[model samples]
Target: MTLLEVSDLRAGYGDLQILNGIDLSVNDGEYVTIIGPNGAGKSTLMDSIFGLTDHKGGTVSYDGEDITGLDTEECIRRGMNYVPQDDSIFPTLSVMENLKMGAYTESELSDEKLQDIYSRFPILEERTAQVAETMSGGQRQMLAIGRALISEPDLLILDEPSSGLAPHLVDELFDKIDEINADGTAILIVEQNAEEILNRADRGYLLTEGKMQREEGAEAMLADEEIRQEFLAG
Candidate 1:
């Protein structure tokens, strides 16, 4: 069954359209990724789906319910979580405080949930009392992801989760993403690093100029000479 569906999504800032008739669907427990050039409207698509942008026209359905035009809170309440491309964490808050914030809507927040997340990210456990601003780049990203997981969302959207990381750290982050998916939370990641993301994604979509140029297995796309030339040949 499909967990999320976005059909003909058109959106942008002011009068300029960034996402033009974009369509994407993520199946239950599937790991899907969308990659494109810098201005490919990749992040815009994510923001639109999460109700952060003006949806000129489209339908966003989560678990067969139309969440179109729903407020950000409504989106989260519906078991959907979105992590933006940047500023995803509270800089002044301690690591533990940040994780607890993800479940603010819950009537009874559980420390057990925090422990579960800390187990997944041990670095976070060691730095629980430290301010988020004091952490290293990779550690901050880990905290951001850990915080999102605290909500136990049915679908998690990670925007450029590997951005700004060293090559080895990117590999480690992708490993964690795979681990999260393995534990059964469907992942929809938007990334610009075609080569790295394609290597790990179960399926990949190539978005160009607000349109889907191609869709195929991650490995297959990596193997294609034309795709390599167009997106990954750099």
Candidate 2:
């Protein structure tokens, strides 16, 4: 079943349009990745779904409910979480504090959820009292992802989770993402590292100039000579 559905989405910031008549969906526990060249509006599609953009048209439905035009908080209340490419964590806050803040909307944080997050990212457990600002880039990303998972969202939307990380750390980060999806949270990621994401995703979409140019299974896209030559830099 489709957990999140976006149809003919058209959105932008203020008067400038970014996505044009785009359609996308994520089924329960599915791993979906969107990849394209710079300025292809990959992030804009995520922003639209999360209600961070000026939605000009289209319907966004989550878990069989229409969420079009809903505010960010309402989207979160409905079991959706977003981790942007940059500035996702509170710099001055300690690791534990950042995770605690993630559950602020709820009545209280449960120990079970906290323990789950720590298990998924063991480094976070060791650095619970460390300041977020002092951590390495990869550690900060892990904390951001861990904080988002504290809510136990049904769908976790990530924009460029691998961006700006050292090459070796990128694989480690993807491993964490794979573990998260294995535990049954659907993932929708917009990534610049196309080949790595395509290798791991169940499905992949290629966007160009604000529109979806192709949609296919990850392996098929990887094997297509045309796609590899044009987009994957074969």
Candidate 3:
């Protein structure tokens, strides 16, 4: 049951090639992470999938259909959502209001769904009306994630959810991620926190120099000394 399948994806801005024939796949309800060094095209991969970049060549299959270059709105309509690493939320809007924006296309706004999100992130319900600008880094991350969840996407592409947060906050964030996965939405994550993300993931791909070098189970790969020294310490 493959929800998302990317084969030989080549994309870039203008003439600058970022993702070089990248191939990846995510099964239903799988927690997959792509760990890579900066400038290794992690962000570019997400951008290409969400149709935010110029994709020169590739096949992006979502739920058995090709969505190689669908616009953002179209992709969202296809049950695919993206939460980038930065500037994903409206700074001036209240948290609850931001969520309302996420549900703009939905005809029915259910408390049951909102309560489900709030249960996973208690902090969000506590600060539901607070302006997004005033939230802490960790809280902001939580809000960004919550906003995306409002769509109840079948697949959520998160680019570095653990960026710029304290150590403890990362753990809490991953716990929430696990909760989301438990509810049956597949997750595709790109995180710079090698040890942290890999430990929590079900599978991981090591992308470097714009190429995937290795693929393995999250915990098993985390225990590999060479991988730790290369990506974690580098």
RMSD of 3: 1.5
**Tens digits of per-residue lDDT for model 2, 117-202:** 98899999999999999999999999999999888899999999988899999999999999889989999999888888999999
lDDT of each: 0.87, 0.93, 0.88
The parts of candidate 2 lying over 4 Å away from their true place are none
Q: What TM-score fits each model?
A: 0.96, 0.98, 0.95
lDDT of 2: 0.93
- Candidate 3 CA-lDDT value: 0.88
lDDT over C-alpha atoms for residue 229 of model 1: 86
* Tens-place lDDT digits, model 3, residues 1-234: 999999999999999988888899999999999987889999999999988888889889999999999998888889989999976899999989888878876876589878977888889899989999999999999888888888889999999888888888888888888888888999999987778777777999988887888888998788888888888783
Residue pairs whose backbone atoms clash in candidate 1: none
Q: Sorted on lDDT, highest at the top, how do the candidates line up?
A: 2, 3, 1
